[model samples]
Target: MAAVSVKASKGWQKPPTRLYEDNYGFGINFYQPMIDYLDAKEEKRAPKEYPHLPWSNERGLERYSSKKLVKAYSEKDLRRLVEARTKADHGAFTLTKPKTHLSLTETTSAVSAINRKGSTKEEVRVKKMSDDVFDDNMEQLASALRSAKAYAIGKSAKAIESHLLAESLRNLSSNTEVDIRSFQRRAEVSSHDSREHEWFMEQRKMKEEELEQLTQPLDQLKVELLGKQTSIEIEQLNSRVVEAETRLKTEVTRIKKKLHIQITELEMSLDVANKNNIELQKTIKKQSLTLTELQAHYDEVQRQLQVTLDQYGIAQRRLQSLTAEVEEIRGNYEQALRIKKSVEIQLEESVSRINELTVINVNLSSSKSKIEQELSVLASDYDEVTRELRVSDERFQRVQVELKHTVEVLHEEQERIVKIDAIKKSLEIEVKNLSVRLEEVEANAIVGGKRIISKLESRVSREVVSKTKISIPYSLKVSEEKYRHPPRWRNWSTC
Candidate 1:
């Protein structure tokens, strides 16, 4: 009858008091009206429904078997299952990363929470349920044990099992403080332990959360320590530093080598360039001197040409004077020619008387031949003398050959003497000019005399230079020996 009324309630709210008290494992909802009814049912002699349980679902028992957990699973087996699950859930946990340690702290904290004490006895008994509650776990555990022994008697095994179950559920439901009358009548449980366990569970949950919070500091400390620790970061940084140092060294060495090479090349290039500049300077100096010498020669030539032009003008005036003189001589020569012609006529008359004498001379030469025969007859008386004369004639011809040889020898000697005389004459002329020039140079070396000596020496040197070369006629053209015998100035050789 009690179970029937609970199933039929339309206004029964959920949680701590909705179906039966044991259902509070979902959460405890205390319903004051439902509590009054549950109190009423506690005094009844009938079976009742209890909703929440550790293993208590009608359909689940039929299908997946919550009953199997009750009948087949022991407390130790459940404990093992929970442990295994915890391990499996966190199998990948390692302390390498900071997150892993943090997660471990959380799990430890959760486990520590589960080990907490229950609530107080008086607290459990007086704890006001929600006005719309459905079920509670502590309520259900006390009820099931209360009816277990009673349902065991006077029934078939299957029926006894059902009754025992029903009665157990009924006891479990009444144990809740929502209705004190159900299992409190004759029960092994006390309200004190029940409430204490609840309070302990709550304290344990807070402790677990506190433990997790504590682990945060520890995790932070671990991360800080790792940062200070020696690892790949520092090693790689050192390697990079070493590599940079080596590269810098190599760069320095390369730059130094390049600089040295450049210095050597620059030095050599400068040396060559300096040498070429010096040679060019010397060549420029020599060319400049040659230009000055050429300029001086040109000036001398210009002066000589001017002097020759002046001399030619003077010669032209002299030629006019000589022409006038020759005209006066021509009048005298014509007068003398006319007088000679008169003398020639007197001579012709005298020569005609001489021509008759010349005819008498021709007759005398014819008689002279007969006289020569008489002379021959007379010479027979002097034959010895004629023979002597023939011998003297032969000797005279021999003397003529000797005289010709002597003349040829004399001519060769005369040529040699003439060459020597020519050389002497040229030397004497040059010496006379140079001696005059020297006396002028000595005077020029004196103070205030240099200008006058230079002028006079130059003029005299020019005259001597003109007289140095004697022009020979074409028929008398000789070898270079003539010029060779001429005196050369000391300055000409230097030139």
Candidate 2:
């Protein structure tokens, strides 16, 4: 069995048919040499014991177990039995074919038909069914057949084993008979010599035993190859299952992680939305308060605007009345200005007249001073004539005549002096009248005349008063005394 397993492992590298062909060629070459060697050594002394077969228990079973052999044989037999049974039932089981392609409606109808029929009559009814009915009943029939096959396989393990052993024995006997007949024919041809005949017979027996030994190992090799093939298939299936499981686990973990991330994102978005909603509500409240305040402020502004408009109208009317009053005052001021101009003109004429009167007074004062000097000389001459009259009587009469003429001249001079004095007094009265009129004019033209009056007074005092201070001679005073006392010469003239 170990050699067979080794051969199987080597043979797996090549195709089965190619390995079998190679083995057949090697067996032919190997046995030919052995056969020739055996014939040449047949005449020598036989060895004490023949060599053991290469497939003996001590060699083949060193690394193999009997339980594994039994299990493999059982499984192989079970599969063979199931195949045989299915082949036998093929004609009766019409629904087994074309089961995979059946429609829903067809399956339903077939299911109904099967449920209505008895188990004993099922085969006959199924045989009578048409192709459509076969398709319709395909799935259920296939499932039922699978269950039946499973049960039969479970119960028939020993029977399958016995059947396999019987078949192997029968094949071995048939091969032995064919080989023995060929060997007998060779023995018969060489029987002319009795010793050769016996030698051929012994050789035939050895070959037979060798053939028997070879047959058993070949059977074991076939079983081992079958087991190895089946094990390879099972290993492939197991690896596929493992790969699918790993792939499914990775896919499930990925999906779970993705779902967790999405959930976290949704929660964060919800929090942000809540914050935005709260902020919006706060803004709405603030806007409402501002709107109310603005409305109140607008109303207050409207009231103030109305009050300002009314005040503006009142101020405009007051301004119109004030303008009319200003126009009346302007007319009165113009009339007062005209009156002041006339008063100023009259005052200027009065000042010019007063200047003329002052010049006349100055001339009169100068003429009076000259007349006083002349009168003083005439009084001195009169005094001298009176003294000479006392000194000589004869010259007295001539002096009296001369004195009478002088007295007449003096009388004329006195009349002239009296006229000059009267003119000076009239001039003084005119100046007083002018000053009074100027005062009256100043009082009436009160706007610009007080300064004018003060200026006129200062000018009048400087020009008129300084010129009126005239000096009179003392001789005039003596002449006035003699005239008042009436001198003795005048008394003598009267006597």
Candidate 3:
């Protein structure tokens, strides 16, 4: 919580300049006690023995050293000798451990002297005096006890003698005056002793009664303690039971929420499947319509091609008949020309008639060749059309196969949808039963604490919070646009 508080503070981002300067300010401040203890220890010690010994700083040591101490050491040449010895010994270069002999000589001598002189003499003196004195006290106590017994016996005998003499005097009443006076004194002392004894007995009885009265409250306190122990145990058991019940309630609620979420997810999945099925059906219908229109167009083209082939065949047949007629005419003209050649110089009329027949034969042969070429071109076009029709038929068969596969897929999807719907219905019934059970559990739950547990009276049950169904649509298309495939976040519905 402190860390959180520090993080929340504005100054956390930028600390004060003093924060870095104070070595004691950073990290844990728990060392305050240790620091105080060190300070206390320092306060108990004497002031610095060497004030001019370069107390806090170590640089330029000779400049800070007192002239008197420097002179004293220099005259004795002790400083140079110490430095020379330190330089000679490898270990002396660094003061890893103090020279025990030199550093603690005075301290060790003082401690040993104090212990030998003070502790030993005091211990021996106290031990010897205590033994002798206690032994004499024991003997003195025994002698005092013997003396007190002798004194008590003598006093009792004296009192008894006094009492007896007074009794004898009373019996010889009407005696001399001096005898009466002695008798009166003895009676008064006896009477005073008896009164004091009676008063002491009364006071002792009162003290015993007071002690018993004081002890009675203690017994009551014991009984009260027993009751308190029982109550505390009962309270502990009650608290444990309450904790267990609360834990169970929370667990039940968590399970219920998990089931609710699962149901919601399933419903959403069903919705998505349905929408996908619908879209698939629409696309299939559109594709089938397009295929049908294309097939019809191809069929019409095939019909037109067949008609053109028929016309080409007719044209070829007509050209054949014309060729045969032209052949017969060419033979007649050739025979006529042969006879005209024999009588060529004899007649101009025969020559003119032969020339006209030759021109007619040439025109017929040209027309027949043109008709044959047209027939060849028409046959090529017919073959091309037949190939196109065959390709179209193959394409139509492929389309049919694809359509069959799609239909099969659609049927499978439909079956799954039906199964899912059945499962959904069963789940709904199960959920209803679960909800009813939950309500019963809530109704049966114990409440009203301890007082209610002892009684068998009917109590009003608490209201159960029922889960409501939520219908959430799942659209792959929209989701793809918004979150893409493999969604990064959960889509939830309000319930």
Candidate 4:
């Protein structure tokens, strides 16, 4: 053993000095004071011993655990260790070679002291320690502390990465949820539109049925009115003879004056009839023109309907093509899903293989090289799989984006289709209304023609009666009797 002294000096006070003796050492008392200082500075910490817990005691010591021995840590110990490290970092610490050393023993040791001016002999005691063992223990403790700090830093970084991954996944899930909701809304809108279309179609059918019912009555009324006009004309012709005779008997005395007055009235009535006939002809021409214009408008409507049909056909073809493309994409997605499942299974198998390798590697030294090679191969495969998985994840994200876009496009198309359907329904209703109006106008025109014909017949009968009264002759009786029986077919073409 060797004796060593550590001298502590103050600026204005006598220097303090301490001596240390190495108990179990090969003349290592020269450096014992330094060892004592390290021990004291470390706060009398014991040599770090592994905690023999129940779990650890059961296994005693796994081969891997034995090789990878770790020191247990406490916060207070860590803080003291940091303070000591920082103290050492801020100051220059040098070990000086002690002077005066010859023989050393446990009891009578050589004094190797630090040279100091005005030093007092104040006795300082130091704890006994094995110099070699103490040195080895301090180095181990330092290494353990460094490993612990590194592990803590790595763990923190891993935690941060995991947090970032979780956030990304959450955002992705939220986006997917939004997309799903949009799709659901679109489906609801489409279903609503379909219902509306069905309702419109039903209304159209009902309207058509009503139009047919109305048309039947209108046709029947037209035929009945024409027959009534023909019977009224026949009755008026028979009454004309009696009316002419009554006029002749009443105006016998003033026949010549009456004849002159009657002549003027007949001429005026004839002119009025001509004027009315001309007006009637003009109205008929206008009505014909209106009918022609209506025909042209109907033709134009037909053309527009044909164009709409063509457009509908084109849209159907486009829809079919889009459906085919969607189906193809679905197939591709299924294949990708299968591949992803396979990759996941492979990853699980690789993880199991890695665990087995860890166990086998510890037990078989002769096979260590082979196991390392296999582990390298597995690591490469894992890396390859991880890369593939990353590619799959990217593809999945891209597919999701594409699906979202497609869904939006589909929604737009559905809205457009709904709008077109609404427009078509409106157009159909307008066309039906126009047809109904046209039918009503035609029925009114027929009724107006019947009324005009009746008035014209009455005026012609009165004119003939007046003419006969003014020119009563011997042949009038025969003519009147002949007029009583009208011809079988009263030449309506000439009339």
Stretch of 10 with least lDDT, candidate 1: 126-135
Q: What TM-score should be assigned to candidate 1?
A: 0.16
What TM-score goes with each of the models?
A: 0.16, 0.22, 0.14, 0.18
Evaluate model 3: give its lDDT.
0.43
Model 2 spans > 4 angstroms off: 1-285, 375-495
Global lDDT of each candidate: 0.44, 0.49, 0.43, 0.45
Q: List residue ranges in candidate 4 displaced over 4 A.
A: 1-283, 359-495
lDDT pick, better of 1 and 2: 2
Candidate that beats the other on TM-score, 2 or 3, i.e. the better one:
2
Expressed as tens digits, the lDDT of each residue in 86-159 for candidate 3 is 44433211221123322121323333364343356534543443333333333333443344334434243334
Q: TM-score of model 3 relative to the true fold?
A: 0.14
Ranking by TM-score: 2, 4, 1, 3
- Which runs in model 3 stand beyond 4 Å of their true positions? 1-283, 345-495
Q: On residues 302-404, what C-alpha lDDT tens digit does candidate 4 reach at each position?
A: 9999999999999999999999999999997776666556544544654464355334323333332332233222332233333433443454345335435
User: Which candidate would rank higher by lDDT, 3 or 4?
Assistant: 4
Q: Candidate 2: what lDDT?
A: 0.49
Candidate 3 Cα deviation (angstroms), residue 345: 4.2
How far is each candidate from the true structure, as Cα RMSD in Å? 47.6, 40.8, 57.8, 76.9
Q: Evaluated with TM-score, which candidate comes out highest?
A: 2
